[model samples]
Target: MGEGNWARVKIILRSPASRLKGVCADARFSGPVGRPAVAPVLCINGPEDKLFRSQSADITLSSEKERIKKMLSEGSICEMNLEVELFALQDSNAKLVAALHEANANVEQWKKQLSAYQEETDRLRDQVADLETHGGHGPSDLLKDELTQSLEELESLLKAKDEEIHILQSKKSEYHELERDRGEAIHRLQELEMRNMDLERRVQNAEQTLASSLEERDRAENEVHRVIDILDVKIFDLNDLRQSLAKLIDK
Candidate 1:
């Protein structure tokens, strides 16, 4: 965890065989000569966010240079904590889909019940007609009351079912929209991850190239210094020979 200006971390990695610094650059070591090639940086400002639970610390990274320095000094991290959070988000999305499916199933069941009620109403009407045809008289008070009561009850039940369907439909639509938004979010995350991977690879390549260039430059400079020293020595010998020839001529 990043406490103050410096962060605390534990990592295990072997130093590259080509490393100029023969000693392993682990956290236990000290100074520029013993620094590790790679160090993990605890990101104070993560893009996705909610990774760390931090108390209010007033560590200000106010400049872009500072941010870059921090990023380079200690490389980025992709941790178990972040993965667990993403998995939780995915699980929540799945539960939402399941709930939507259940609501849709409920809607279908309500439609079936509604159809059954209509069929029953038709059957009652047919019975009423058949009795009227046989008796050629009006319906009995008890029969009229019962038929009216049944129709009224059916109407109320249908209204309630309609309201339920409306509510379910609204909820289903909401879930679908949420699913679409989540799909977009996942797509964005995939693109960002790919870009980050590409950038990290490029950075590694750049560092290798830079180190090689610096080594070559230093070798060239050393050769130049050796050549200059040799030329100076020859010049000194030439001056001594000129003085000897002058003395011989004078004698």
Candidate 2:
């Protein structure tokens, strides 16, 4: 058996043995209050309880053997899968080796082609220099005229580019000035808003002060009316006393 199968078999065997030991221990420690108190049986043939325990142990062993057989079969399957993977890896490695050989052959062919191209380029350059040294005067004059015309066109294009750059610079300056004016306007607007808030607060405070003064004036007017009413009552009582004295004198 493989190592994994052997380990599983050992675990299965140990678990049942431990369980049987626990069962025996529980029976030995059982109390007489819960279990019936009976004398031990001594038979000439065999003990009946021992027979029952032996049958249970046989059943447990058979189950464990079946589990071991199943684990061995699984392990064999895993080995076969590992073998298939190893063969696939070997085939891939062989293909990679062949590709590397093909690439090396391609590199050799490219080197040969590059060498041939370099030889042709050198031969053409030599032919061009020889023609320039010994060729006729008429073709050279034509080439010089073409070169002068090309230089004049290039100079005119450069002047136009410089003028365009200057115009763009002036426009950029105007844009910066506009940006500065916008920032100033925003700052001024913020200042005006703050001033408006301060003015509003002062107006509210003045209104409150005016309302308090009006309340104090109304209270003073009411007190003055009360004093005038008391004075009029005292004057009427004096006039009645004077009239009674005059009548007594006449009688």
Candidate 3:
């Protein structure tokens, strides 16, 4: 058993035994037979004395029984307290165990990360060694310088190309605007041409109407001249008839 449990057991046994010893002492003092007198002879003479002694013995016995009961109750309370403490300790131990498990899991994760880092470090070292073996130190330095110069040239070219692209984009916008203006001018020219065709057609129709009017005017003038000549001949005939009539009258 654990030290705490053992101590609790000892306490449980000790209290009851001590109280029993006190009870035994009381029983011995209350005995009426086979025991020596503890008081003076003059003090134990008559019926009153016997009654008093009996009452004293009864009181002592009752007090001893009560003490024994109290001791048993105290022992039971101690046992209950110990049990409560044991449960509390068990709960604490379970919590500690859980915490330890969590800590172990964290440690394992860190170890994995550390291992991956170590592998990366080894790879880098190997790459450095390979680079060293492939070329002498001066060659590596020259290669580094060449790579840096190439990068700078590439960057400069990219910047120049970007500027060219910007200029082209601006020119493209201007071309688009010019194209739109040309389309508008073409549309206006088409409208003017249509208007000119309509005006030409109107002039042609007016000329045809004017020709028909001229032909009708000539026909009317010729009919008028023929009528005037016929009138002149009739007048001359009437004058001749008048002269013939005058000669007959004279006869």
TM-score of each: 0.52, 0.41, 0.39
Better candidate number, 1 or 2, judged by TM-score: 1
- On lDDT, the leading prediction is 1
Query: Which of candidates 2 and 3 reaches a greater lDDT?
Result: 3
How well is each residue in 1-251 modelled by candidate 2, as lDDT tens digits? 46776665456436875445434434433432232234222232232334444455546545554555555555555556545555555555556556556655755665575566555546655555666778842335555565456555556655765675576566556556555554555555555555556555554554555455445445544554555455334433433333443344344
lDDT of 2 at 70: 58
Model 2 TM-score, 2 decimals: 0.41
Regions of model 3 farther than 4 Å from truth: 1-141, 238-251
Clashing pairs in 3: none
Count the clashes in each prediction: 0, 0, 0
| Top model number, TM-score | 1
lDDT of each: 0.55, 0.51, 0.51
Residue-level lDDT for 205 in candidate 1: 61
Q: Is candidate 1 or candidate 3 better by lDDT?
A: 1
Task: State in Å the error of residue 101, model 1.
Answer: 2.5
In candidate 1, what are the lDDT values of residues 48-151, reduced to their tens digit? 13211111111221233345445544433432334555576677778877887887898788789878888887877887888899999877787788789879
Overall local distance difference test of candidate 3: 0.51
